[model samples]
Target: MFTSREGVTLDSIAAPLRRWLLNPVLTVPAALVLSGFATATPNTDSIKFLVPVCALVLAGVLLSLNDYLDKQFANNWVSDNTWNWDEEIVVVTGGSVGIGASICDQLLARNSRTRIVVIDYAPLGWQPKQEETRLSYYQCDLSDSNALRSTCERIRSEVGHPTVLFNNAGLVRGVSIMDGSYGDIEATVRTNLIAPMLLAKEFLPEMVKRDHGHILHTGSLSCVTPPALIADYAATKAGLLALHKALQLELKNIHNAPRVRLTIGIFSFIRTALISGHTNVPNFLLPLLHVDTVGEAMVSAVYSGYGSTIYLPGFNRVASTLRGGPEWFFRILREATANFRINFRGRHEVDSQTGKILKA
Candidate 1:
């Protein structure tokens, strides 16, 4: 019953439902009902357990309804011009590896005439072999305003003012706030949060003048639910979510730049250098997303030309709602989930220069 094209759509239905059923508000009520029934019957453990099962089933139905609505809107209302890569200049930050690299590869493959500009300090191990003339690389630290300004100027000259900008660069110092240094925290904020705002400021005006462009911001699961160890990363991601929302509103409502599409990607853990070591989590609960899948989702969002808050592996929309729960309950759930860790030694080693994990 599943088609390759509809796989992501189906995933969207399943992912949110799983996360919704995990909410304490829903679970607690079910638990209370089960407890009351058990007390009355004295041997109703099986009956009590049905509460969670029923809640999960209900959540699934609701998620399917949402997916149906989304598909209807996407098919009918969304613009398709954003997918015309041939007429667009594509600029991607942190396109050297992982999700960014995958996006670049897919973009290049889509249109040989598309001028693709990759901004990263170093090369990703796997570069696009096709369309060599169409693709160019710029080496600069996006966090530095001076460097970014210079890079933007150079790109403008070489590739023309970019029509599609992907603020996909991100960093994570996989340590607790107590153990992480100030530099580590600052680096995470600078790269993840500040850079996107600055890039938008620099390129958005040109897009508005041209009256056509697409901007995609790569957000994280941490934006919706803050994890324990990566406090700084979480804060930056949350800021990104807010920034994207505000920008979208400003462009659509105030500026009347409806043609300027702003897309936010709310994705979970993917099999990348960033999470190379962590593998203990349940695959059903938190499956490691494929790099290609991440790229395809971004492409689909951009092509659809409808501004969206996309959550990969589907369940992330549920996580966003559960974020409103009491802090104590949320903290307990986060701590329980934090037990996953990667076996760094057993995984492919990442190169210091390129940041690409060597395929074993």
Candidate 2:
């Protein structure tokens, strides 16, 4: 609380102490210590002391799982490749907008030599930040496999093999199966699920040969708890999660390319154009995350060679495990918020911009 030059002040102590008390991680350990004292006291109920201690330990282990996984990946990947932002060529999918753009901003600013290539159909000419020559843009709709391959080949030829790949491109119509178009369905599945696999197919082998690389897949809360209305979106996300994990196993066990790090990001509702005009589950429980913050985290992990399945606003990690819990919990959450699907309002895609049920 006190600077060495200033010595301790009452005000300085209070603020630091208050923050320590408010921090759940620190507070839990403090409570456990107090519980230990209580259990030792005569006539004090042992259950009261034991209850919170058990909870603290359980939560600690669950959270440590991410750390353990990261440590394991680091041992394999970092030992071979190591983290060098300057030498690494980073390629981000869908970098023309939203979190992808944010990630590009961070990486470009992070190191002058780290080249960034953005693959997206959208024009990045509108982006003010991309004025710097450090970032390159390739116009290719990932849904078109031929266009995707051609673009990748061009990137490989021009930029060298990208050592880091951010599979962040994603889309959702926010409509039910009946309301969705065949074109839209194909686009959604291709963009969200198939494209990521394709990108991996294109880039992963190069990483394996070099014995160095990182792949961060942008998963969703939908992977754990599929919601109503956006069934296709949720399904694609679930498939992404499964396939991403399978890719990790195949890389490490089959190819013996332990140097390739895989990270999956399961984010809740993010404040981005993709989810614009949409509502989230009660903000009190799950707040809308800023794109910049999420992007920074993603960039930091890859740039620093950290690896793990990260849950943004990390409490969602515990929430995700609820799937294995009782049915009543699911029913209550579904009934309480109605899956955050209320904003859809039963509109079908009658046009490119607006949705309204047709005369039929």
Candidate 3:
């Protein structure tokens, strides 16, 4: 159950201030203002004045660029247009579990005219709370090319062309490269990377013809700050980032489908069954990302029709900027901050003889 917002307290009053302090948009400007204020003295120091002025201008320019980048994927979802959720069809892969299921829940919460299709080989253990009429499921093993083709064709005939595709299916074997099998590598790549490619090939042509669609690639923060464990998992997520960027460019420049949006979701460790056993950074510093927050954000993007890399906790936008630093810096930071559960890797089944992970 959710708490009602009828009551106002001291914490409620401070909420706006907290948000303002935390937002990078406001913080950048605040930093510039502080720098400028310090220079407004009677020291007759022209260097200080010039430097602060330049800094403020640069800050303004960067902020403007950031705003433009938010709409970078497309000019598709304008606020004033006659476009609506009622006319949309949403397709989610790996939608039977974890973050994927949460996204489906949010889409149904809209209770609008949008239709939803969930493609997964795994049978659903739980149903949507919304008791939806616009949602359906298809048993498709996404890693299997033949299964994907047949299932997608069925979806096309039964439901319609999916206007939005959430490439959310993923897996984590949680073993080092030296410990993992070739089969593990193949499965990880097929599910995480290759499946999305096939889905696009099947669906993107129609979207381009109509010049309308949104593709959301749910990537991970690991793409930038990779840990020592889960080598194949990180590789596939990093591939998502690359594929999303390339797809967006193809939609914009080559195909002239500027309205076809491809958004990248770069989130940290989200609390879900998908990564339930995985290690995390200290909770005091980096809390586990709630499913509700991710669901709400994804639904908002789908309805609103703009796309870009969405960082969880909002503060994770820093991760993109941090990528420009030296590789060793990130390695040290990862070890110091999130090294606690790194050893816990897979399930609790180690080989008694060789002291290696028994199941990979």
Estimate the Cα RMSD of every predicted model relative to the unseen true structure: 9.7, 8.0, 7.1
Candidate 1 Cα misplacement greater than 4 A, ranges: 1-83, 131-133, 326-328, 342-360
lDDT of each: 0.72, 0.72, 0.70
How many pairs of residues collide in each model? 6, 0, 0
lDDT of 1 by residue, 1-360 (tens): 222322434564544555666444565567667767877887757575866666765665676668667654433333545456677888888888877888888877776778888887656547676845488888777656778888998888877888888999876767687876666666667777888898888889888776678899888887766666777888998998899878866876677676787788888777776667554766655667888888988977877666677887666777777779888877776676567674222223333334332331
lDDT of 3 by residue, 214-303 (tens): 888888887877776677888899988889888877877799787777787888777665555434554433456677767667777767
Off by over 4 Å in 3: 1-15, 18-65, 72-82, 277-280, 342-360
Instruction: Estimate the lDDT of model 2.
Output: 0.72
Q: Following a full C-alpha superposition, what root-mean-square deviation does model 3 have from the true structure?
A: 7.1
Error of 2 at 25 (Å): 13
Error of 1 at 195 (Å): 0.9
Show pairs that collide, candidate 3.
none
The residue-level lDDT of candidate 1 at 357 comes to: 27
lDDT over C-alpha atoms for residue 238 of model 3: 90
Q: Judging by TM-score, tell me the better candidate of 1 and 3.
A: 3
Model 2 residue 330 CA deviation (Å) reads 2.1
